[model samples]
Target: MDVDTAPKPAGPLLALRGISKRFTGVRALDRVDLDVHAGELHVLFGENGAGKSTLINVVSGTFPPDEGTFQFGGEDISHLTPQRARAIGISPVFQEFSLVPSLTVEENLFLGREITRGGVLHAREMRKRAAALIDELGFDLDPSQRVDDLSRAHQQMAEIAKALLGRVRLLILDEPTASLTERETGRLFELIARLKSQNIGLIYVSHRMREIRALADRVTVLRDGRHIRTLDAATSTDSELVELMTGRKIDLLFPTITHKPDKVMVDVENLTSADGSVRDVNFHARAGEITGIAGLVGCGKSELIRAIYGIEPIASGTVRIDGRPYEFPAPRRSLKRGMAYFPANRIVEGLALSRPIRENASMTALDLPAFAGFGVLRQAAERIAIKGVMEQLQLRPPNIERPAGMLSGGNRQKVMLGRALTRELSVFLFDEPSVGIDVGAKLEVYEFMKRLVGTGAAVIVVSSELPEVLALSNRLYVMHHGRIAAELSGTEKTEQNVLAGFFREHLLAEVA
Candidate 1:
């Protein structure tokens, strides 16, 4: 049979059959099945803890299923190792940053398979290849630049370029545009379209409905470790896709904000950083209101927030809380003043992934009477306190003994929020709190934030997603070149207006 008339085999280019995995009574994948075809974009959609990640992990060789068979290219490869999976043309871009921070772009790109002559590595050839790759993509990044210094979007592009350097037949991208700007996402889509023309298969895993609608050719919905439905992307709406994954109609993804804005809670004047990432920034967060800071990557938003939270040294400026001068030389000092912060990278700065939920949740409130006993951490008391928090947050399994790492992305975020809540904080700072979570989970986090503000705590959210900012914030501030360029509140807080203001200044200058 010819390639076109081969009856389009009933299976898939890759297929999982009767896959099952269990960890301590939790069925991560319960006889689940999925299929992907050549020259098609397959999307996996599910809420957090619905076993989507487990299914991908099993297929990518991160782990093996207890009972199942994996057929790739009509061959049984059930027990292949991760290295073997990659060798056979399977590539995965994980949500976590996998680049070597200390290595240069050229070195990181060709780390495992450096160009060599006579058993010696050829540095010149590696640099030339990296330069060519950067030029081919029309990116202005320097090949010699250290990976650590590159912006998050540039780093992600480098990862994609590295994967393309190999003989990849199947590409699995997990939240590839979670932090990418609109322009960068457009460029990525161009690259993906180019790859699709060559008959390569793509498995795109993302929580953004917009991206799925634009890129996916076929969509698969998974719920609670079971394969729910597979549909043609052209025939499905975002609401329909979401309902399939969540098993319910979601009228509003963002919760209604009910808290009324009152007095100013956080006031900063002429805040400056030594590196010039943040220069003479001034802003105030109002009590019971969500003040969002929107900016492009490397625009110094994080640095400014760090200075406010006392993680970064302030070169010159004053921070005041309720008309009182607040100078915090460390994060502990900031916490002592009734302020809480959820850092951008949850795995690194937010939680002790290997620690149990009880320990991680109680870490921020160890000094409280409920969890402290005679200068010692009261284990029983801590568990009791965490139990209440877990219930309030709607965490699954409800087991305090599970390691934080074992939970899903959404659950881990909840753990971080739980930690912050334990502090009795009057001011809350959330930095990209919904980065890698599912759409349904993102809604839950937004609702939780609304409830937090109902207690009169002022909230500051720094996010790259413009829509999220428009939805959750009562007032929005766009940061450009380390300064607030535009502020929109009330009826003026539309996505178009915010984006127009952002581009009017930056885009005009670029064109001129």
Candidate 2:
């Protein structure tokens, strides 16, 4: 279904004039004007709280703009609802998934838009269409498989497929490849090219510089809830884009910290998860060193750390902390034994979104005397500590009483990190620490890691971003197929060496 021969539209496919949206205490978007042409792949570039998400929500009818006029196909479509937007060929694939875990791939794909004949459900037809669509998209997903059985990468693929199921003239993708593997990301790029050829306008939101260089024809920079500038992707340098998105000149994104390796704080020997996502992995995180674990998506890097922290079931393993064996580890026990884990998805696993910042920050050490006295909560003490931590993290708005859900992605992550400050911990595990935050926020996270290692703590960083890990880690481990493929340090930590470790040859050469 290529629409390469279709006639081009005269004006923009989607146009907004003075778009403004406001929440209880925040103006998410203010007086923003944007033009998205047919067949164009436009990228929304901004730091968190810069209003990129709000603009897309407005376009996709998640909410109406408080003020402004938007036109689609030369007709006014202000105050649009989600149903109307989808009916008129506007689809949005948000970062948060909307699929039911219990449902099959096809079931989740065509949940509300199921086909029927003579009041009978067209189950077979739906399966056929879903299979065809999956094949056409080159996604390695089975229509019969339950979504819960699929990996995060596959779940992301299913989300994208769901958005592309209908008559989509404008497709909105918010951090679509945040969970995708390299191969799957390539397929998505191919799909985007085909969609562009079909004259479907796409609005993409991503913080990854490589993705912007590869896919964005034009990039719209948003800053401080206003439209900053729209520049050609080819002409815009990374430094210029970073400066525009962050509203500040960042001389260095990653802070330099001297890695003075002390005694091994955490020692894992022949570790294997119950489900075998992590298999017989061996590594050590030394005090005063940022130990980095690098691998491809689904390579069990996160699973390894989870296993060490007792978040995942260990079939056979031993984790020795400070030369003492810790058997049958649990979260409470891990926290009690001076270990803190910051999960990859901050919204899902790290923070209670409905709770206030003070509550979330002090949740880690509530049993301690500083937070509670003889089973009674100390609100004053908790507030003072949380205020200090929030200030150190530079949380935007600095409102301790505000809900965690109201803050930006960066601030939410800060809340999770703030938990560590509430307690005295020696081992810190950060999984995809700065995944979806801004460059400015990422710098802060890097500095935070630097400061943690300076205190002689064992800071283990697990990241999919190669440069981030390489820059911060004193000792790095590359995982492949759920095992430690290579251990690299000093001259061995080069990109070529690390990438070689991603495949089987590095391990094979080690054996040879």
Candidate 3:
């Protein structure tokens, strides 16, 4: 093939042709073609099941392509193993991190590919090398610090640092900035620029269009396991990209709804965790409003909510639902009291992905008379009970027995919401519900939140996206270092104000 030759056509550093993959009855990719050039950031845009993950996995050697070939530096290396993939200078940073929580940054940096002598670990040299790498990347992190102790942003940095440990020529990042703040995202962009300067090829997979505009040299769209088309990023509009990705253009990202909060539903006073990660947290959610919580990644927003749901043990707190005291370390107790907590990662914590929708939805109502006793699921009764919420949330295909994993990002969330709706609730706690889903999915989740709160149920939303919080919440609280820093409402519900609140303590300390 002319592709495998010296002086490779000033073209792609890596080129994939006619790639196809199948799993069971599902054809994940079909004749997908992609090209990534050295010194270029190539963006792969696709909706769920569009073959983006399959293609990347093929390149990363997670699995072999059933058909087609991949050329690396002009050589057809289609049937390569993961070791060979790394040996040839390809490193991938996936959305779910691989860093071990128990290990230090230095230890994790050289984990499997460690420096060894006399069949013993070379800890000192590894630490030195890791320290140098962190410094080179301009990351503010201590090499000796445990991975569990680091903030999400710092953990992300550590993930990158681990990937760059080898002679990396092509770096693939999947949703790298999904959890990062604006400032953190800027820093990542700067680092990417530095890598690009070294003539390294970059495959950046992101749902955020702003990232593509800011970084992409070219954009490739995949649809239903086939290559749709590739366009120059500079010339492509977001609408055009959306059309290419979803096959339909959505003009509105969010639906407008007036927020009218009524009487208090869930009230917390002096909430503090044993670890002090969440300290003296005090807030309230009204019967008909979204109480938004916004802060940087490490702040106590997550822990504070977890404390209320009885997931995180509270050292001192008073939680009241409908003006009555509530207890901690008792999830069933909280659930029975009409309080539902939805986690950010729906796949792992929120729902059993492999299970049928019937089981997932009915899990919340196991204590209900129709679902209890005999230790066997009353399938017919369960379906009838969950049918209303499922229809209301508009789960695609409306298949009651579909596995939760088969649904798209948006539908998966709806499944969680459906389960929540089945239970009578006074307070609904959502933590970053709109993480990786598309615009349409986000609007659906937003609509669900509105509907739930409209039924005289209180909702507390903790999101990193300031616009989302502002749009969904009637009242907002910003946390910094385990405490509520500022509370905003009405005219004060601006992104700028929320950010100010996020850094209020730091600003005060700096001023002092």
Question: What TM-score does candidate 1 reach?
Answer: 0.93
Q: What lDDT tens digits, residue by residue, belong to model 3 across residues 1-512?
A: 00112332487899998999997667889998899988799998887657777788899998899999889888889568888898888998977688999999999988778999999988888988898888888788899999999877788889988888878878999889876777778888998998787778899888888789999999999888899999999998988998778788778766666667788888889989988999888898887778999987768898888888888888997988788888754678888888898888776588888899878887888987777667777777888877776888777658878888777676778888887867667788899988877655677788888777667778899988777888888899998888898999999989888878767777885787
TM agreement with the true structure for every prediction: 0.93, 0.97, 0.89
lDDT of each: 0.83, 0.91, 0.83
Tens-place lDDT per residue, model 1, 42-157, is: 99999999888888778778988999889987889967777888778787787776789999988988888789999999999888888887777665578898999987788888
Q: Write the per-residue lDDT of candidate 2 for residues 77-171, one digit (tens) a residue.
A: 86699889988889899888899999999999889899999999999999999999899999999999999998878899899889888788889
Weakest lDDT window of 10 consecutive positions for candidate 3: 1-10
Between candidates 1 and 2, which one is better according to lDDT?
2
Best by TM-score: 2
Clashes of 2: 0
* Overall local distance difference test of candidate 1: 0.83
In model 3, what is the error at residue 381, expressed in angstroms?
A: 4.1
Q: Which ten residues in a row have the lowest lDDT in candidate 1?
A: 1-10
Q: State the weakest 10-residue window (summed lDDT) of model 2.
A: 1-10
